[model samples]
Target: MTLTLAIVGRPNVGKSTLFNRLVGKRLALVDDQPGVTRDLREGEARLGDLRFTVIDTAGLEEATDESLEGRMRKLTERAVDMADVCLFIVDARTGLAPADRVFAEILRRRASHVILAANKAEGAAADAGVIEAWELGLGEPLRISAEHGEGMTDLYAALMPFADAAEAKTAETAPVTDVAVDEDGEAPALPGNDKPLQVAVVGRPNAGKSTLINKILGEDRLLTGPEAGITRDAISLQIDWAGTPMRIFDTAGMRKKAKVQEKLEKMSVSDGLRAVKFAEVVVVLLDAAIPFEQQDLRIADLAEREGRAVVVAINKWDLEDEKSVKLKALREAFEHLLPQLRGAPLVTVSAKTGRGLDRLQAAILKAHDVWNRRVSTARLNRWLTGMVEAHPPPAPQGKRIKLRYMTQAKTRPPGFVVMCSHPEKMPESYNRYLVNGLREAFDMPGTPIRLTLRSQSDKNPYKGRKKPGPSKLRKHLK
Candidate 1:
C-alpha cells in the first residue's frame, strides 16, 4: 500500500502550489484568491525516492455549520483523518494567524503524523513568520518555498520514517505472488487492466451537480450549499457504482459567456470544457422547474459537437407537482428543441432523495455501450445499399451521383466514410438522410456520428518527373 499525505492550511498559504510541485503537475487549481479549492483532490506524489498518495484539501475555515465555508472545513477535516501524514503549512510572509493556531490544535488531535512547514520562506522578509510558526507547539517548522522549491530535502527527511513504516506493514500483510518453475515463470504480476471509465457532469449554476455526486457517494464528499457557483475546480473521484468502475468528474457551474467576466471564473469554465473533451459520457443536469433553458441547450449541443455520448438528466424532480404531465412535456420539448440529440436518454432524478439513480446508471451504461458500438464493413455496405435504393441520390445539372460503398472507419462516437461519385455536388439534405438511416439501422442512438464523402478523383495526381533546365526547355520549345 502507498503512504498517504494530506496538505492542510488556512486560506492562501500555498498548499496547492506545494501539491503541484510534489505531484510534478498542476492537477489542482492554484490562485491568489483564498478558498479556491473546495474539494479534496488526490494525486500520486514523488519526493526523491519516496512515493505516496497526496491529497490537497480546501483551506481550513472556522465555520462548522451547514454554510458553504463550514462544509469546506468539514471536508478538509475528513482529509486530515484519512491521510497517513498531515503536512500542516503556514504562511511565512504573514505571521501565524489565530485560525492557523486553531487548525493546528485540530490536526494535533486528529492526524496520526504531523509535519509543520512554513511556506514562502525564500527571503529575509519571511524569517520572523518562520520563527512564529514554531509557537504552534507542533515541533520545528521546516522553512520552505513551495513556489521556489526550497527546503525539500528537510521535508523529505521528516517524512522518511512514516514511509518506512508503511512499507514494512505492507510487506507483512501483502500476499506473495505465485511462481512457476517452467519457462513462463507465471508472467510476474502486471498491473490490473480494469481501469475506470471517465464521466463528466456539467450544467448551469445551481443545477445540483455536486448534490447528485454526493448522493452517489453516500456521503457529503463534495461541498454543496444553496448558493450558485459553489464549485470552481473540476474535481474527479474514482468510485465503483453498480459493479462498474468509473472516474467521475464534477465540474463547476457554467453560466452565460456574458456573465463570466472574472478571470478566475473564466479559468474555471475552461477547465470544465477540458473535462468534457476527456470524458466518455457527459451528463447535462438541468433543474426540473427551469428545464431546456438556452444555456442548457448550448451545453448539451457542445457535448454532441465534441463527439461525446450525452445523457440529459432533469434534477429536483421531487419538487414537481405533476410528474407524469411534466415528464411528457419535457420529452416533447427535448425532441422539438434539440433535434440533434433526438434519441439521447432524458432521465428524471432527485439528487436530494437519491430517487431514480438506478435509472440514471442504466442510462449511462446504455449510452456508453452505444457510443462504442461497431458495425462490420459487410453489414454497413448492405445497409448502405438499402438506404440508397429507398431514396436515390439527386441528379444535379444532369449528372448522376452514385454512392459506391460505405465503411465505418472508427468507433467511440462512430465515424464512417463513403466512396461516392460527384462528392462535392452531394447536398447536405442527402447527407442527413444517410446519417439518420445509419443511426436507425445500426441501433446507434444519441451518440454523435461523423460521415465523410470521398470521390476517386479527390486524390492528388502529381507527377514525380523533374522539370527541364532553361536550355533544354528552349530546345524543346523550338
Candidate 2:
C-alpha cells in the first residue's frame, strides 16, 4: 500500500494539469473549459524519488443536492476522505474566489492531511494570487506551475512526511489477497495470464455506460445521473467480474463528429477511442428505446474496425413494454444494420435493475473466446477446398483466380492470408465468401476477421525478372 494524494479544487484550476505532471502522462483529459473532468481518475504518480497513487477529482462546486454539480462535489469529498493527503489547488491567475475558501474549509474538516498549493503561479502576474491563497487558512500556499513543472521540489518536500507515515503503516498491515481465484477459490492463473482482460464500455451519450458498469460493480464506483455526458474521462476500474479478472474502462459518451464541436469533448472522445484500441473486448451499450441508431451503428463499426471483440448490450430493458417483439426487431435490426457483426451476441440488460447481467457476462466471455479462436492450417485449407469447390472464384478476362492455399495468420480477431493466382483481381464478393465461410466453419461469428489475398507468383524465383536476354543468361551460367 502506497500513499494516496487527491488533487482537488474548483473548476479549471489546473488540478488535472498537476495530475498529468505527477503521473507523467496525459491520462486525464485537460482543457481550458471548466468542469471538464467529472470522474475521480487515479494514476500511479512519481515525483522525484517518491512514488504514490494520485487521484484527479472533479471540480468542486457549491452544491450538495443530487444535481450534476452536487454529485461531483460529493465524489470529490469521497476522494479526500480516502486519500492519505489532499492537495488543494487554487488558480493563481484568477486569484482566490469564494468557492476556494468554501472547499478549503471542507478539506480542513474532512481531510486528515491537506497540502495547500496555488497552481499556475509561474509568473509575476500570479504573485498576488499566491499571496491571496494564504487567506484560505489551510497554510502558506506552495507556488507551483503544473504545466511548466515549477515548484515540484517544494510539493515533493511537503509530501515526504506523509509518504514516510504511509510506508510505516503499509509495513505493519497484512498482505493483500486479491489474487486470481477460480470458483473453487484455490487455483492460480496460468502462465502468461497474470493480467486481467481489458474491456471497454462505449456508446452514445446517456446510454447508461456508467450506470451499467456501476451495476456490474454493485457499487456507485462511477458518477451517474440523468444528465447526458456526465462522464468525461475514460476511467478504468479493475474488478473480479463474475470470477473473471478484468479491467473495465467506462468511456465518455461519444457523439457524432459534427456535433462534437467543443475541444474538451473532442479530447474526451479521443480518449475513449484510445481505450477501444487498447481493449480486448468492447461492450456497446445501447438504449432499449433506440437500439441501433446511426451513431450506435458507427460506434459498433469503429470497434470492429479496431479488431476488438464486440458484444451489443441493449440497456434499460426493464422499461420496454414488448419484450418478444422488441427483441425480435432488435435482432433483425442488428443483423441488417451491422452485417459485419452478424452473429455477435445481443443481450438485453437493465442497468437500472441489474437484469440480464448474467447473460451479458456469458456473452462477453463467449465473444472473447471467439475473438481468440484459432484454426489449424490443415483444417482451414480443408475448409477452403470445399468453399472453392462449391462456388469457384470468378474468372475475369478468362483468368480463373484460383485460391491455391490458405492459412490462419493470427487470432484474437482472427486474420488469414490466402495464396492465390491474381490476388489483386480477387473480387470483394469472393473475399467476403471466404470470410463468412471461415466465420461459420470455425465458430468465429461476430468477431472481426482479417483476410488478405496475395498472388503466389510473387514467391517464384523468376516472377519479377524480365525474361533474361540470351547473352545475360549465358553470362550467368558461366
Q: Which 10 consecutive residues of model 2 have the lowest summed lDDT?
A: 187-196
List the candidates' TM-scores in order. 0.92, 0.92
Among all windows of 10 consecutive residues in model 1, the one with the lowest summed lDDT is 185-194
User: How do the residues 371-451 of candidate 2 rate in per-residue lDDT, one tens digit apiece?
Assistant: 998888999889989999999999999989878888888988899999988988888988898889988888888999999
The lDDT of model 2 is: 0.92
lDDT of 1 by residue, 1-478 (tens): 9899999999999999999999998778888988888889899899999999999999999998888888898899899988899999999999999999898999889999899999999999999999999899999999999999999999999999999999999999999975545476555443222567789999998999999999998988888889999988899988888788888999999999999998889988998999999999999999999999999999999999999999999999999999999999999999998888888899999999999999999999999999999999999999889888989999999988988898889988999999998999999999989888888988887889899999866455776667799999999999
User: Where in model 1 is the C-alpha error above 4 Å?
Assistant: 175-194, 458-478
lDDT score of residue 121 within candidate 2: 90
| Candidate 1 local Cα displacement, residue 68, angstroms | 1.5
